[model samples]
Target chain A: MKCGYSYDELTAYFDGELPREEQSKLRQHLGCCGECASALEELRFVRSAVLSAWQAEIQAPEDLRSNVLGRLREEGAFRESLPVKTPVATGKGWKGFKGWGAAAAASALLVAGASWAWLAGNVDNAPLNTALIENKPAITEHIPPDKEVKEVTEKEPDGTAGGSATDNQPGDKPGIKNQGTAVTSPEKPGTPRQTDNAPQQTATGAIALKDYTGKAFLSVDKKSYSGYFQLTDNWRNYDSLDQKIKLTAAGYNAALAGSFKDSGGVVTINVPTASYNALYEDLKGLLSAGGIVKGSDTTVESIESQYKVVQTELEKVREEYEASAGDMEKQNQLANRQNSLIDQMEDLEQRARISTIAIKL
Target chain B: MGDLKTDVLIERCRQGSEAAFSELIQIYQNRVYTICFQLTGNSEDAKDLAQETFIRLYGALPGFRGQSAFTTWLYRIIHNLWANELRKRKNKQTISLNAPIHTEEGEIDRTPADEKSNPEQLIEAGEERKLIWTAIDTLNQEQRTVLVLRELHGYSYEEIARGLGWSPGTVKSRLNRARLHLKEQLLKLGVKPDKESQKDADIRKKVKQL
Candidate 1:
């Protein structure tokens, strides 16, 4: 019942937290004591102002409720979109079919000999046989008898000494024998020389195989299906066998053109094969070693299969070259065409290298 | 009016009636929003907190035991949620409650209207409010809670003590300190102390009693 209270007691009294007896006493004191009473009054006024200010209503924007509802709906939809128990498959699985088709195409090229192979697969198949036959006669007619004679001797490395009768004591016209030999040479070219220097001589003629001993330059013109291969040696005056080997190294599969003396020991082989398979293999190996295989599979089989397909296509081009006119112009054209195909094949090989399989690598 | 019929409406909402929930919102939205606005000191936050309170109420309706008044339970939830939010923000090193409040759509609109009031009057009123709010903000978390319940929400001291799990004496002491702080703030705001003001307040109380 004190008239003069502490600041703490005054605060308690203002908040109505004083005990009943204390509250009555404080009220009685406030009725008489002006200072305590006024202090309590000012506190009440402050409380009122604070309460009113704090209780001031806030008007929410018109769009808030709708926006919240919309967000909730969107959240629901997003949750629903997540993949549940079932797995979803997209496009049809045509990968297997495409792979089979590629293999089949490669096989078909191999079945057809070089002459008809390129033309049959890529160009008109109908006129390919006729073109082959026409080029066949010209190749037979233009090839020198000496060149054939050298081939015959080269084929028989063991028969090189005693095969003089087949060459000199020829009673039958050499032309007829040459024609028969020419037709049969492709079927079985006597002993297929493993080494280009090994001489291959047929019964009708001596065709010495030249060795690619020196630096052999293999040039692939992908725009043209022809690759130019040349062998340069130190000796200028070489034998027919050396010349033939150099030409073969150039990828020349044609009947031998007579060996001509050039200034240097440079033996140029204008092999009219559509592409250089051995060079392709070397390049393919280099690419694979450099880690360039397309798709995910960089396996040996994948690289080899890709190279084989390219080789088959190149052989087809070579056949087309032989089946066409055997003139230098036709040969050059075929070489150019084959070079282009080879370029495309190389690009595809590169694509295959850097594809999904390469990613794994 | 008729015991506010809130319990009946809440029961209807529990029975999966959307209309009943909407009616409930209409009935208590203002009070809930006022409570949030008072706590947050911004309309946008108030609306957000209020809406959240109702949404939580709806979700927890099945579990509501109805041991207490619906509004009291809801106020408790809102207070707890706001306290948690404040604590979270504090932990994040962002304690500026007076930073311009943004609407849910990220628009700022908190400047009080001037209307016909003179600049001096407006500023005085604004400063007084700011001072009191700042003092409230300075209270210990529990003191602030007890003060808000007793003074702002007008809950009885016993109710506040029960709600906050504090003894009545603790609640009284905390409220006393809070009010003293508020009075000192008002004195700094230049509100003149007058004994006649207490008699006026007593007369208003007596008339209400009559």
Candidate 2:
């Protein structure tokens, strides 16, 4: 069938902007119409060429941040504005879920710097930084499984713990949750803490490959969420890395299990530790520089020992919580610690069973 | 930045927090610079435009009523600033798209290039990239702005219209013309999608479907 669709429609369709009914009709037409398909293919060539030319991960000059901030400082612009009570302060379900919120905030802050490094092409020991931050592989859109986690937090009578109340800043959506396990209180205005996620030392050699294993936490229904390594290599980006991971996983006779719920670019696959190195080497070729650090070196014995340490911490927090009289603040802090410890144990237990490599392209 | 986090930063900025403002700059500096660079096609101009955009953003924060996505608002500021710069240079050339070419069947907005005109030589991926940038360099201000907003930033037609303060029809037609013109220019430069890119495109399409 010959399609008479105009070039405008074709461009819109190629960009995935066509409306649903028109999109479906166009899709059917392209399936049967060689002329339209070839036209669409040509458009892809143009996009690819343009992207290749202009999209090679250009970083703002190192001093741009300092320069912008310096300019603002000179004008006293930052000093003139004050925090206003915004209408979007809808964090009811998130008030007491300090563990997830803090971890997410911490990881977000950490990844903000790490991704700048990734684009700047100067990530020194990126894998070690990744391990420390627990930043997911997908630099953008790495929100953890929130529906189940939020439900857990909602059951508690005291969900509004920590400094969230004092923070008083609005604009928190209850629905979207940030993913990561690191913790930090949300920074207040005027505080010098967490001012800059300074770019790491420049990467001079190939990216060291590390085991991109993630910490899995199964909810009450057996669904698991983990922190995946974000694929930030600008040239290959997400699509190329995704394809590479799939091919490597198949070659290793592994199950490309599934991705985390609600997160795009995160893929969870279970490759045997024996065949992991071959798979790792295959994937390493995809990286431009900065090798992945071997993050998942936890043995059965090491996990066992770590599990014991977390258990002891949990016990200590539990004792403190029980011993506390009527101080809500102290009790709240203890409760948060207890919850964090329990989550750690669950993470350890899951790691003991099988290693899950989540590639967030 | 996550929407919530960005909101927090905006709030802090309003609260006269220099640290919060600095963090905001850190998060968005690269992106803002990329937009500026794409429009100006040079690092120096891009740096100046980006710095100017933030300075304007800081001044305009009290008026940002959260009516639009922060990015949408920010990009709108960029477009306005760039348009103003082009006016100052007095070189803002709007491609004359009003003329239609008469074909045997009917009038078309643009003539389809003869497929046989494309060079058959297989371009190395690196070489292809250099040629692509050269082709991009040939685009005028309007075409380059539309292409950058659509392809690099992935803004939709409606969003582009709203950001650029044009009607949806204008954005759609301009973006389409920009794409076709870029393709035509690429072929003119003897650049075609090499085998590697073709394979990657196929793989990307399948992944998108999955």
Candidate 3:
């Protein structure tokens, strides 16, 4: 459009967009070059046309303001902040905001009760040989001379071995499939012999124990197995039931750990041997009230020597701490290490002493 | 500087004043509607986009710290939303509503002809306006956007560059090219020859002033 400059430059010049020197040059070019001047005129004319055509105001739809506000309302912006006062909230049903209030109140009352006898038989984390050594004096009275403790076998309500919700993990063998009938039925004959569990430690190395004649088999298992029960609720009222059972387990000196599954209605937990015997009746009655006890079955698992190794390591660390003779940092490390080993041993022993009861809803 | 009234309204809206937000929407609704309508060229689509802009603004208003004029922030929203909508159907066959709808694969006027008994009323519009709109449709999104912002909405070159996230040089060049391209299209339409003589006295007066 110009002598050497392009139309874009001419357009820029028309709009007063060029630098001062470029503007002066373009102004001089326009005064001399008719072609460049005409090109700038064309740019102005067309741009003015576009301006006129597009500048006319298009009226907005009348309801647009209300519609925007209405959409925000529809998105629940207004309702989200308000406490949802539905019938469930008002009635204090077990699943709503009001229900939570009621639950909190109930839990407060229960905590105030503090009924668990945790000190009477704090046996879950008793020292490794405490039971074998302390209870050995009583073992000869009831246990057979040759019979060793067998691992507890777990059975679901449907009479399936290890098929209960508690036994879902592989190789998690539990005791006594038909032991419900055996325990409930007092006349079931029994001959005391060593359990065919194929002891991991030989008879020489295993805890030398005078096996209690059938008296030690108070649980759903044949052996005086570890006191872990994986109790699950088949009933719909599992949350409260779970909380209640946990409180009951703690009240009676039991270590309970398991979440209540929503769908399958399963809860796995541990109750110490003493606590199990104490709460078994009350637990059965509580669950039976909810109609979940019928589907509940206990599976006791055999305790392995993992705890023994931890205890041995802990003892060695303690001896090292004593020999270090006030090497405070090394002693601190050894003390920390010793505490960690003791904790692991306690956790293992607790697991070993509890019965796993899986209740199927 | 931003509008003081709008700033006050924004402050109250951030403080959870619903009525203030509603006032803000009412104040700016026409500008938003016009921008969306000009871009979309359809009343129904424009209405939807205008309302949608306000709904988005309702959600975004709390975050507006007034870094720029509310109108600039508002325009950015319109531009982004319009660009996304254009990109969604950009690759598809564009609807030439005057053309037949049926084809092997192309954009069809889903708005059936029977819906509008007098569809030719659109053609009966000013030929210059029609030509201008057609030429605008031909531009890539950036050129058309910058051209519209500069020529129609009166945004400064710097403002458009900031809003579009382009350098000032890029905005200026694209706007120039858009005008040149529009001029070419206008020439091919043979509109200048027929009307230039009558309007020349007026356009020439405006041009000399420019």
Alpha-carbon deviation at B126 in model 2, angstroms: 2.4
Candidate 3 per-residue C-alpha lDDT over A14-112 given as tens digits, one digit per residue, 9 for 90 to 100: 666779999999898788898987877787666766664553456677777766654343222221111222211111211111222243334221100
- Residue A16 Cα positional deviation in candidate 3, in Å, after optimal superposition: 3.3
Candidate 3 chain B, run of 10 with poorest lDDT: B100-109
TM-score to native of every candidate shown: 0.39, 0.42, 0.42
User: Clashes per prediction?
Assistant: 58, 24, 30
| Tens-digit per-residue lDDT, A1-361, candidate 2 | 1567877778778878888999999999888888889998887777777665553445787767666654343222332222222211212111222343344333322111111111112234322122222332211111111232334334322221112111222222111112232122132223232111222233233223223233222111112222222222111111121233322311321323322222343343332222232333333332332223121211111144456777888888888898996989999888877866776675544333232233333
Q: Write the per-residue lDDT of candidate 1 for residues B1-210, one digit (tens) a residue.
A: 124487787766544344566567666676676667566645655666776666545544544555555655677767655654454333233345445443222333233232324423534634545534544544545555666666556666777665545677877777777666666654544444433433434433332221
Q: Which runs in model 1 stand beyond 4 Å of their true positions?
A: A1-4, A54-56, A60-361, B1-8, B65-67, B86-146, B165-174, B191-210
lDDT of 1: 0.40
Instruction: Please give the distance, in angstroms, between residue A92's alpha carbon in candidate 3 and its true position after superposition.
Output: 39
Q: Model 2, chain A: how large is the TM-score?
A: 0.23
Candidate 3 at A333: error in angstroms? Answer: 66
Cα deviation of A228, candidate 2, in Å: 50
**Candidate that would win on DockQ:** 2
Interface RMSD per candidate: 26.8, 15.6, 17.7
